[model samples]
Target: MSTQRVFVARLSGCFVFDPAGDRLGKVRDVVVIFRKDDPPRVIGLVVEIPGRRHVFVSIGRVTSIATGQVITTGLINVRRFQQRGGEVRVMAELLGRKVYLNDGSGTAVIEDVAIERNRLGEWDVGQLFLRRPRTSASPFAKGPTTFASWSDVREQQNPGEAQSAEQLVATYSDLKPADLANTLLDLPEDRLIEVAEELPDDRLADALEEMPEEEQVHILEALGDERAADILDAMEPDDAADLLGQLPEERSEELLDLMEPEEAEDVRALLKYGPDTAGGLMTSEPIVLSADATVAEALALIRRHELHPALAAAVFVTLPPYETPTGRLLGTVHFQRMLRYPPHERLGAIIDDTLDPMPAAASAAEVARLLASYNLVSVPVVDQAHRLVGAVSIDDVLDYLLPDDWRSHDGEPPAASAHPTTATIPRRR
Candidate 1:
C-alpha cells in the first residue's frame, strides 16, 4: 500500500524485491498509456524474472520505488506483458529520445523520467531530466543536467532513423492542431513539408494556420497547385489571403486559379488592399443582417456558432438586399445592445448611428488607435463607396501593434546550455 516516486532511469536495472526481501528480478521498462486529452498513466512494470520470461507487475503490487530497489506487494503476475496500440514504454522508447523544449531551444536527449501518482492513484509522467549525450564517460567528467515539465517537451523525430513518411504521418496524425504545428516546426524543412502533404486537407489547414507566415508559404507552395488550393480553400478566407500575399505574385495567382472559383474570389478581393491597411487586416466574413431582422434572428445566427466570438462582436445592419459587398450601410448594433433588446424588436429600431466606420485604406496603426480609443472589440471597414467590406477584430489589430518578432520572443528566454550545473531534483538517497 506504500507509494514512492522515482525516475524511470533510476528504476531501470534496479533489483525488484518481494515482501519477504527476496529479490525477484531487475526492472526492465515502465508501461504507460498515451491519451490525447489526459496525461499518460503508468499501468505496470516489465520485470525480468530469474530463469523465466519477462513478466508484467501491476503498480498495485508495488510497495515502494527509490534508489536501486523496487519493493513489491509479494504478489506479481507471471504472464508476459504485451504493449497495446496506444501504450508507451518509457525506458525502452523515450529514455534516449531527443526532444525540443518550448523555449525554441535546440534538441536535448531525455535521460530520465519523473513519475508521480495523482490523487486518483494513477501514475503520470510529470517531469523529465535531460542532458547532452556524452560520447565518453570519465569519473571526473561533469556536465549540466536540465530539468523541465513534461508538457513543455515535445518529441522530435530522429532523421538518421529510416522512418517512412507514412509512419511519420501516422505518428503525428492524432495530435492537436497546435501541438502538431509545434512538432512540425522542429522538423527539417523538407521533412516538414513532406509530412504535411500526407495529412488530410482540413487537418493540414488547421496546422498551417498555427505556423509562422514564412513557414506557411513554404509548406503551401511545396504542396503544389491542387493540394495547395484545397488547403487554402479549407482555411479561413482572410488567413488564406494573407498567406498567398506572402508568395510571389505569379505563384499566388496560379494557386488562386486552381482554387474553387468562389473561395478564390473571396481571397482575391482581400488581396487588393495593402497589407498595412484595414481591408488587408479585416476578415471579409462577419455576422451581418438586414436592418429589419429581429433580435431572435440575430440570436439564431449567433447560435449557429460558425462565427468566432470576435467575428460576432457586433451585428451590422444594411439597407435593401444585404450582401458581402453590401447595399447602403445603415447604423451598427453593438453586441451589448442586442442582449438588452426584446426578441421581437428590429435591429434597426435600436441601432447606434453614432459609431462611425473606418475606411478600407486606413492604416493598421490608425485601426489600432480607433479600436483602443473606442474600447471596441470589432470595428467595421467600409470602402470609399461606403460599401461594407469587412471588419477588423481587436486581436488582429493588436498583432499589428506589437513588434514584428513578437511571435519568436513570446517573453520567454530561449533554452541555452548551463555549464557544470545540476538540477534541484533529489539525488539518490
Candidate 2:
C-alpha cells in the first residue's frame, strides 16, 4: 500500500553510500518534497552523487535520506552505491517504496515527477500520482490510472481552490473532453450527471460521447428530455442514434419528440439501418450533389450545404433522374480535388470513374475489405438499378465489424458480427 511522488528539492549533500552504508561521494542537491501545508509529506528522495544524475528513491525505500549521511534500504541492497563524500550536496534517494496521499487517494505510486516554479512565485510538485488498484502490479506499481498532470495535483492540494462535486458543476465545462473524460471516470456516476447537467449542449455531447457506454447512458437518462434532445441533436446522427439505442424505448421516443424534426428524422433514419451494417450504420445526411451541375456549381452547392455528417470521402454523383431507377450513379470526387478544378469544368469531367463504393447491404466484412482497398471513407450504395441510394461511412463500417463493447472501449467499430436486433435496414422506395 506504499505510494510514490518525485523529489523536487534538494535533500542530501553530494555523498554516496554503498548498499552496506558505506560513504560514496559528497551529498549533492538532493530532490526534496514540496509541502505547501505546515507538515509537507516526504513522498520520495532523489539521491545525486557528483558523477551520477539524480535518481529518485521512494521515501518508503529509504531507511533515511537525512544529514550526517544518506541511508537507504535499497543502497544496502545494491552493491555499487558505496562511496566517500567529496563536496557536500543535497541528495534525496528515491528508490524502493514511498507513501502518498493524492486526491484523497491513499498509497499511490510515483510514475513520474516534475517541479514547476511559476513566474508568479508559485511552486508546485508534479507527480504522476498512482491509483490504488484491486490487483497490485509488481507488489505495488502505478499504471495508467495513476497518471496526473501537475495542474491536477495543484488543484488537489489547494483546499481553498478546490471545490466539491456540487460546487464544481460549472467548472466541468471548462475542461477539454479528454481531461473531462478522465475526471468523470474517477468521479461517481451521479456526480458526472450533475456536472453534465450544467455544461453546454456541445460540451455535454462531446463529453458524453467520450465517456464509457454505461456512463453515457446514465447521463442521457438523467438529462431532461429537452436537454438530452439538444445534446443529441448537436451530436452526429450516428452517435446520437447509438446512444438512443441504449435507452428505454419510451424514453428514447420522448427524447426524439423533443428534438428538431430534421435532426430527429436523421437519427430515425440511422436507427432504421442495422446497427452493424452500412445502411444501419451509415450517415444518412451526405452531400449528394446534382449530376447536371458544373464543378464550380457543385462546389458552390457544397459550400452552401457545409459539412454533412455522413458525406464520407467522395462527393457522390448521380446521373439524370437522380432519384429514379433510370438515374444511375456516376462516380465520386474528393472534395479537395473539387476545389482545384476550374469552375467551368463540367462535373462529369471531374468525376473519378475509379472511385470505389460498396453496397449498403454489404456485410461488415465486405465493407472492411472495400475500405482496406480504397481511400474513400464512405462507399455509395446503389439499388438494383445502380442508382445512388445512400452511403456507408468508414466509421460506420468500422463500427459494424467491431464488437460493441470493444468499439466503445477502443473508440472504434465493434468487432463482433451484427446484433440480432439490428436488422432494421431502410425499406426501398
Candidate 3:
C-alpha cells in the first residue's frame, strides 16, 4: 500500500469493497485511539451496511484506501459498533471541536483531520485544519482558515463551550431529513445539541418531525424556549401538536405562547383531539383548492418542491374558504385524474366524491381501513359541520402503526454465517 496522506472528510461516503469487488457498505466514520505523546493511531472504519447497521472494519483488514473506494480483505465483524475508553470517532468527536493554536493566536475550530501511513505502515493523524472563530452576529461570515501539523495544536477546549457544527453538518448535507435524523441520533447528547443549534430552523423542524417524541422533547427543551417556539412554528401543525403533547402542560403552553398566533392556532386546534384520531394525525396544510380552481393551478401547487409526497398525490376540492376547516368538502382529485383532463378544465368537472370523507373523530383503525380499502395515499377529514379540516397521509398512519422502537432499529442483522465474523478487538483503556 502507498504511504500517501488521506483526508478524513474525503473518505466519508466512499464505497468499501471486498477482494471480489462486491460492495459491502459505505464509510461513515474512522475510529482512532489517542496516544500519550504521539498522534492518534487509526484503528478501524465505521461501515454502514444494508439495514442501516453500523459494523466495525479493522484497519488491518483494509488492503488499500484509494480514491472513492476502500478495499477490504472480506472479513468484517457483524456486531454493532460501540465506543470504548480512549477511543474516539474522528468525524463525530474531533471535527467542529474548539482548540487553541500553540502559537500566540487565541482560539480556532478543528475543520478536518488527515491520516497517513508511517514507516511501519500504520495510519496516524498527520495534519489538522483549523479556522478562526466566526462572529455569531454574522453567521454567514467566513473565518480565516489555516492548516498545521497535528502537534501544533495545544489542547481542545471543554466540550460545553460554544462549538461549531459547520463542518459536521456540511459533511452530511446530501442526506434526507429522516436519514439526517438517524445520523444525529448517533451523536452524544451535547454534540447533538450543538449540531441542532447550527441547523436552519426549517431543516431542524423537518428532522425533528422524523424523530421519536422523546428525542423531539429532549432536543427542543435543550434549545431555549424562544428557539423551540420558532422551530415548532416551522414544523407541520400535526407534528408540532404531537411533540407538544409530550411535554408538560406548563412548558408546552409557554412554548405555544411564544409561537406566531396563526401557527399556534392550528397546533392548538389539533391538540384538542386524541392523538389516535384522524384529526390528530392529519396535516392542516394539505393542498386545498376551490371548486373553480383550474387543473393548471392544481398542477402548479403539486409541483411545489416542499410539498410532502403523500400530500402531493392529490388535491382536496372544497367550497369558498380554501384553508383548513374549509367551507364545505366537495371532493378529491387525484394527480393522475388531473393529468388526463385539459389544463384549463375546472377541477369540479372531474371530482371524485364517491368516497365519503372521514369525520375528525374517526379512530385510527377506521382511517387505516379506509386507506387500505380505497387504496388511497391520503383521506380527507371533515368537522361536524361537514367542512374540510385536514388530510391524513399514509406516511403518518404508518408512523403511528409501527412499533415504538421501530426507529431505533430497522430489524435483526443478517445471520453471522452469511458473512464470516471476526472476534471483537479490545480497545486501549
Q: Pick the candidate with the highest lDDT.
A: 3
**Could you tell me which 10 consecutive residues in candidate 2 have the lowest summed lDDT?**
87-96
Error of 1 at 116 (Å): 13
Model 1: per-residue Cα lDDT over 250-356, one tens digit each: 98899899999999988999999998999999888877899889998988877765466887778888865565688767878887798998999999899898988
Off by over 4 Å in 1: 1-180, 188-191, 409-411, 414-429
lDDT of each prediction vs. the true structure? 0.75, 0.54, 0.87
Task: Please give the RMSD to the true structure for each candidate, in Å.
Answer: 17.5, 18.0, 2.9
Write the residue-wise lDDT of candidate 2 on 191-248 in tens digits. 4555566667876777676665677787777877778889999887777888898888
Question: Candidate 2: which stretches are off by over 4 Å?
Answer: 1-183, 292-312, 319-328, 353-357, 382-389, 403-429
Q: Sort by lDDT, best first: what order?
A: 3, 1, 2
Model 1: what TM-score? 0.59
Evaluate residue 210 in candidate 2 and report its C-alpha lDDT on the 0 to 100 scale.
Answer: 60
User: Residue 184 of candidate 3: its Cα lDDT?
Assistant: 85
